[model samples]
Target: MLSRTIIRSPGRTFSTSTAMLNRCIIYTQNGDPAQVIRAITYPKLPSPPPNTVNLKFLLSPINPADVNTIEGVYPSKPSPTSNIAASGLGSQDKPVFVGGNEGLAQVVEVGEGVKGLKKDDWVVMDRPQLGTWSTSRNVPFHGVIKLPATGLTEAHGATMTVNPTTAYNMLDGFVKLQEGDWVIQNGANSAVGQLVIQIAKNRGLSTINFVRSRDDMGPLVDHLKSLGATKILTYDDLNDKSLRGKIKEWTGGKDIRLALNCVGGEPTTAISKLLGQDAHLVSYGAMSKKPLSLPTSLHIFKNLTSHGFWQTNWSKTHSRTQKEELIAKLADMMKENKIRAPEHTIVNISAQESDEEATAKIRDVFAKLAEGKFGKKVLLKLEDTAT
Candidate 1:
């Protein structure tokens, strides 16, 4: 939970000014990731305290990490709040922390003490957690950022949190690659994978991307090549005895210094085996749901270093200026068509659906995602007038 402290400022005490109104998604008991889609009524919001702001969500994406939270596996937990004046069905009940990590919104109202924001301005939360899935939110002014006017769509803005940032930071965070240094990553068709390819291309770095060997491998490879990936391979290549030799031949036996792994287990070991001496392997995800197993040979002979990354943890250490600058650069790339938003399959969750039905639907999607059947990103659209 985030620590709260009171700041001394002369003003009227903040209090609820309007009738309580909010429709939110919640999960009290967690088992399967899909079992978590219960809805609850929100209490009326109080008028913003001097330095607070109220925002209406325009859009938000449902990423894999969000699904992990539902499965009760994520490191962060939503903080529960009390319901004081609930009005909808089950309103006379306990409080629940809203679930979701990011969104794009518009400022509808601001407190008297607010100076940098106003009504109708587009903005996004800098630290969205456990509540962005709702129609509206009251956040501290410091947590809000004014969106750039560079034609960034609501969908793009909604997705501004995880995938794009991961792509940017992962490539830029590790060792500096020259114009032709080769970078490799599994899950090459993933949202982050695609972005990595494009960003690397823009920076003049080469990429060798790996995806599963499916019937559609040809088209997937072509698509990545179109995004400037220099080489594409599949999981089958991992077991091919001649694969490392092929990579050596492809790069004229030049040393490859960096590898990105989202898939763990044997795939991670394969990547490590392919790295040059003193190379870096950055693991940002455990998509395989399996522990990462390393080979003793690579550690003793290859002189490779393994590092783990979590975007939420990274955000804590990064300065505000660094965060904003990275976003601004990504926005520029999008405006110039140097980078593209991930393809998404939006699933609408309505206020009308029964609890059982909604939970089943979310669960089914999670199952498919776990099986690696979804060809694109998954998003849950909350049916709200503000959305």
Candidate 2:
């Protein structure tokens, strides 16, 4: 608790009578992160602006896109800055960008004019490019999005925005799919792919899932099937020349109208060959680090449209109310236990760690992520999020 409670509601600022230090993953230059990323601390925060709030980090995910953005390859990049807030960040010789794009945080202090959020209330960085890999931040009221703290665990709330919403929109936004309509997706065990299986199951849509062959492939396949995948196939199955004919016989000439491809290269090409006429092939990722190759025949004769989907872009174009409705819908399913959290590895970033230790931990995690080790989502859970 603060020594004195400063309640400034509409046209006032909170007095800087209290001190809060913020620790963040900061990158002043984009390159090999092993050489650049650092941990910086903000000694104290001044009074919040009339339209802003102070938030302490709860849990932030380490996503592939976040890594790429740090490497300076991703399209949606966070702003490099030395002056995003008065949190003592500008002392650096050069401007820097924080790591993380998605995470859950809790409000600790609010500007008098801030509405809908209060001390101890949970919030997620609903909007894009807001650097989230930090212990705390002073964010504009409009830039922060709040979620109920009880329904979602740190993992659920931290991750709820991007992948689930992406899968939800791709399924419901592009096509008018009926109960029996079929959808096929590569990377079936990916965070988004798993969500697709559950959401599709809930909507009565049949899902055909494909994953890379692994030693534990059978168990993975079973797990997905339990999540409601109608069928699971491996990349090897896609290569089987008899696959299309087999699908034709099994599906009884059913139209597989949509395909989600995160693994590109041959896998994308092979899946495109199975779509019905005028099907939509949405590419959201290229885990294989290869370009998408669609058969000319599939496009020319079947009239398939190859497209891209970015959840960030979608958020920009749609209304916040619409996004809230979708979040509420997802929440209902979560409350019903229809949405299960994915397996993940948590790295604790507390207020006590030194810069070297934090940097080493970050490098270690990134190495694993780069090597694709530990088939689980990596999350940095903060130990100082309490209001």
Best by TM-score: 2
- How high is each candidate's TM-score? 0.84, 0.89
Colliding residue pairs in candidate 1 = 16-46, 20-44, 98-130
Across 302-386, the per-residue lDDT of candidate 2 in tens digits comes to 9899889999899989887888888888867876778887788889976567667877888877877777786899888654322
Clashing pairs counted in every model: 3, 4
Candidate 2 residue runs with Cα over 4 Å from true position: 1-20, 83-93, 384-387
Q: Per-residue error at 219 for model 1, in Å?
A: 2.4
Candidate 1, residue 182: CA error in Å? 0.8
Worst 10 residues of 2 by lDDT: 9-18
State how far residue 134 of model 1 sits from its true place (Å).
0.8
Best by lDDT: 2
Cα distance off (Å), candidate 2, residue 21: 2.2
